[model samples]
Target: MEPLNYLASFIQSAETGSFSAAARRLGLTPAAVSKNVARLEASLGLRLFQRSTRSLTLTSGGERFLHQVGGAFSTVQEAIAGVAKDDGQPAGVLKVGMALAFGREHLLPLLDDFLLRYPGVLPDWHFDNHPVDLVGGGFDAAIGGGIVLSPGVIARELLRTDLLVVASPEYMKGRAMPDHPTELARFDGIVRRSASTGRAKVWTLRHDDGDEGQALLRPRVIFDDPEAMAYAAMRGIGVALLPMPHAARWLKSGALLRLLPRWRGEAGTVSIYYPSKKMLPAKTRAFVDHVVEHFRRPEVAAVFDSGRYR
Candidate 1:
């Protein structure tokens, strides 16, 4: 078998975590998949994986090999697809990474439209609450809220979302509302620990009058998961700063109320980012345009406005 085919089989096996699963995907028998892996391992003289009756795990050597060879294989696939394109229709697998909340709230609805518009494309989606290195992971595109972009990646703003300080209506009932950023010190705060850097995100707020003053409030309760933090806020645990989309439904139902609305905190831009490449495939280009158009709708804008968490 060709080196590329062997590499592909190895990658499939590693990703699926079993020879049978990989064989099913590759249209080969389980024994054939096992033979390919064994041959490849012998040729390289390295133990790629550790296997047992119940589980399979990548060895240190296998991990490194996958990272290097998987990236190369993706590049080859992209090149082949680029040459194979005709009549403005692109054909290839487009891997996308997105934040969990955004993917469910906004992206899920638009996916069908994108696929219908581009029938030649196959999509693989990976969702996480934290940022990921798109190019390193062979992702064609990423949709996320934060503005942080890794080197060699390009970002286009899809929409602007304002951060908000919110608390359960029960929590806000009789207590005096904080009129300024400084007053936030008196309220209990919930913090989202950064999954990328493993640091708690400090809540930053600013006055609306174009004043330069800002407040960085520390959290009384710090959690790694944003959904959990939002749940705690719903239960009236403390005031929390959250993305507008995540906090919107609760705010609309009166379960949570925005605090200090007049004080417009820092505005964050939701953007689609991709690796800066010489030629973007037609499918990727089409999907990017589709997302931009979707977010531009007035009704979509209203959702974020209603859920404004500042």
Candidate 2:
């Protein structure tokens, strides 16, 4: 067997944690897998795995090696699969990372249309609130705001993230409606704190008439998620500053009312992140094009634009 075959055996053994399991995945006998792994270790002069009667675990060297090669190997497999198909059609798992509420509300709705265009692409998506390491996590792409672009990563801007002050009508029954942003401190506030910085988010509200004010909200409840803040506001807990995309549905259904219609909190843009544009995978390219086109639609763009809501 060649060195590539030995590396494959070693990788499979590390992932599956047993020679028998690796053999099953590779369609080889346990002895063959073990022998290939041994050959790999001998060639590198490194002890890769610590084996026992009932356990198989990677050493420090093995962990570092796997970390370096795992994503590269997966890309190679994807390329091979893409080539093996007819006419170089995109075929394979398209791994993506995105925020949960954002993905469901905006992106997932386009899945049917995307699949119709590229039937061979299977979306393997991860939804979390935090940023994901694109290369180390083996993700084809990620979508959200405030993601730091690493050396080899590229981002395509989708739209500006606009936040609005909102609350349930029930919460405002007897309270005085504030005419200025400064009076927002009088209301109970449901605010979001940054998970990374451990500081509460403060937005400077701007109006079309060139007036500006800082929303000094008194925090009655604090959450780490914008969606949670929206939910709390809907239950009449307090006023929440929320992204228009997450608050649109509830606001339309009259479950929540927009406050301070003249002012908006301008956060940074939301974008899609992928590896360098050079030699990008066909599936990822197709997905990125679809997303960019979708957001360009007037109706979809209006939903996220604070100016329209105001």
lDDT (10s digit) by residue, model 1, range 25-73 = 5667878888888889999999998989887779999999988887677
Write down the lDDT of every candidate, Cα atoms only: 0.76, 0.85
For model 2, the run of ten residues with the poorest summed lDDT: 77-86
Clashing residue pairs, candidate 1?
A: 164-309, 164-310, 165-309, 165-310
Q: Write the per-residue lDDT of candidate 2 for residues 1-310, one digit (tens) a residue.
A: 3877797788878866789867765668889999999998999999999999999999999999988887787677666657677577776789999999999888999999999989989999999999887754657899998788865689999988878899999999998777778889999999889877898888899877979999989999889988888899989999999988788889888899888998887767889999776437788998999999999898888777666555
lDDT of 1 at 14: 83
TM per candidate comes to 0.67, 0.75
* Model 2: residues with Cα > 4 Å off, grouped in runs: 1-82
TM-score of 1: 0.67
Q: How far is candidate 2 from the true structure (C-alpha RMSD, Å)?
A: 6.5
